[model samples]
Target: MFTAVFNSFESGMIYAIMALGVYLTFRILDFPDLTVEGSFVTGASVAAIMIVNGYSPIIATLAALGAGFLAGILTGLLHTKGKVNPLLSGILVMIALYSINLRIMGTSNIPLLSQKTLLTNIQDAWAKTGIDDVLNGLLTAIGLGDSLPKTWSILLMMLVITVLIQVGMSVFLKTEIGLAIRATGDNEAMVKSFSAHTGNMKVLGLAISNALVAFSGALIAQYNGFSDIGMGIGMIVIGLASVIIGEAIFGAKTIVRATLAVIGGSLIYHFVVTLALRVDFLQTGDVKLITALIVIGALLLPLITEGRKVKARKKKRLMELQFDHKSLEEGK
Candidate 1:
């Protein structure tokens, strides 16, 4: 059980990066950039292929970011310059990227189990520096050293990286350019009135959003030790689940708060999924159905609770009015 929770948190951090991208386009830019579905596999394929070819993992990952950036720009241009509908523009780019990712990978899948990826590199560094032994000893003292996973170091590394990215996003959203991008989402016409170029803001925002999504994909490929053509399918829905769950539970009234909420949502989503999978009656194929049910419940729960509260308040108001009317009749 401990091992399951540990693995879930590590995987959650990687998914949170992609979720942050979704939040940027969905909540901040108010743009439904479905490019995410393709860009995710683009990142994984780019990184996997490069690593298999002996390139540094860092370079491979950054190249994935660049690929996703271009994908997003294409979608943005289609909408802003070509006068294409936003949803259709995303679909076009997403469809195009399917072939592009295959070309980059040169196959439907790229295995990296034998390759030295970023995760392996970090583990190697820790072993060489003697930090691994020290941490292992500490864990053993707490009785977790025996039961925890060999890749336990990944959780700490990912937690640090995730926090850094979240802080960076929070800071960026407070900057003038970030403010412009956010304002464009809130009111494109009003931003244009201020002499700001809303089109450029949209393009920039989309580029950044997809870049983060790709970065997350690269990390995921390294962690999973392989990349598949279909790995990105249904990812957008998962990202939305994280965003909605996070905002609903954590309350996203500010940018900092919202970013924190996204990370928390990702963790919670994974934990719940892990726990649900342990049910004796459930099979592995039921994961998507579980995801769908979780999302439906997350979305409807708040509304249902709010509706009940509204009814309660209305009943209370009616009772007060009735009591006042009866007192008036008695006095008369």
Candidate 2:
């Protein structure tokens, strides 16, 4: 159970980055950007291709981000500049990126079984050098040998990365341009009232959102040791699931709280999915069904809450009407 939990968390942290990008679109910008599937693959393909060509892993990852940004910008342009419907624009870009991704791989898949990735390199260094082992032995002489595992390394990395993203997003949303972007989502006319360039804000927001997504994709491909074309399927659903689950569970009343909720919700979602897969009753064949159900639940939760409120209002109005009729009868 401990190992399973650890592995789930590790995987969840990677997916959480993708969830953050989704939150930006669905939660903050309230845009249904289905380009995630293609942008994700685009990032993964860029990273994998660059790494195969002997480029530094970090640079390759950045290149993937750039690719995602460009894809997002194209989507935004289609919607805003070309007057395409927002959702249709995303679908168009997503379809285009599929071919682009295939072209990047020059094939359908690029397995990283023998390739050196960021994780493998780090693990290799730790094993090749006896620094940690030696330190563990020294610490064991006292009382800290049990605490010597580098378990904190992955956790620390996730924390640092998540914090940076959250802080950066928060700061960005506060800037004049960022505020305008946010306003564009809330009220396009209000944005125009401020004389803000709505098109520019939309483009910027979409680009940044997908850039983060691409970065996550690159990281995931490196960590998972392969960049499969099919890996990005249902990514938008998963991201929407994360954002919905986060807001449902934690309530996105504040920016920081909402960001944290999305991360937490992603990990929780992965944990639940893993558990469901392991359950004998659910079985592996039910994975897709389970995912679909989870997504449906997330989507309906807000609506369910709103329905309850509506019912309560209706009841109150009915009681008020009854009271008015009774008083009028008495007066008559």
Stretches of candidate 1 above 4 Å error? 129-146, 305-332
RMSD to the true structure for each prediction, in A, is 3.2, 5.7
Which residue segments of model 2 deviate by more than 4 Å? 124-152, 300-332
Query: CA lDDT of each candidate?
Result: 0.91, 0.84
| TM-score, prediction 2 | 0.84
Which prediction has the highest lDDT against the true structure?
1
The TM-score leader among the candidates is 1
**How well is each residue in 128-224 modelled by candidate 2, as lDDT tens digits?**
6666567568767887655455544454466678778878898888888878888888898988987999888888889988998898899889878
Error of 1 at 232 (Å): 0.1
Query: How do the predictions measure up, each by TM-score?
Result: 0.90, 0.84
User: TM-score of the candidate numbered 1?
Assistant: 0.90
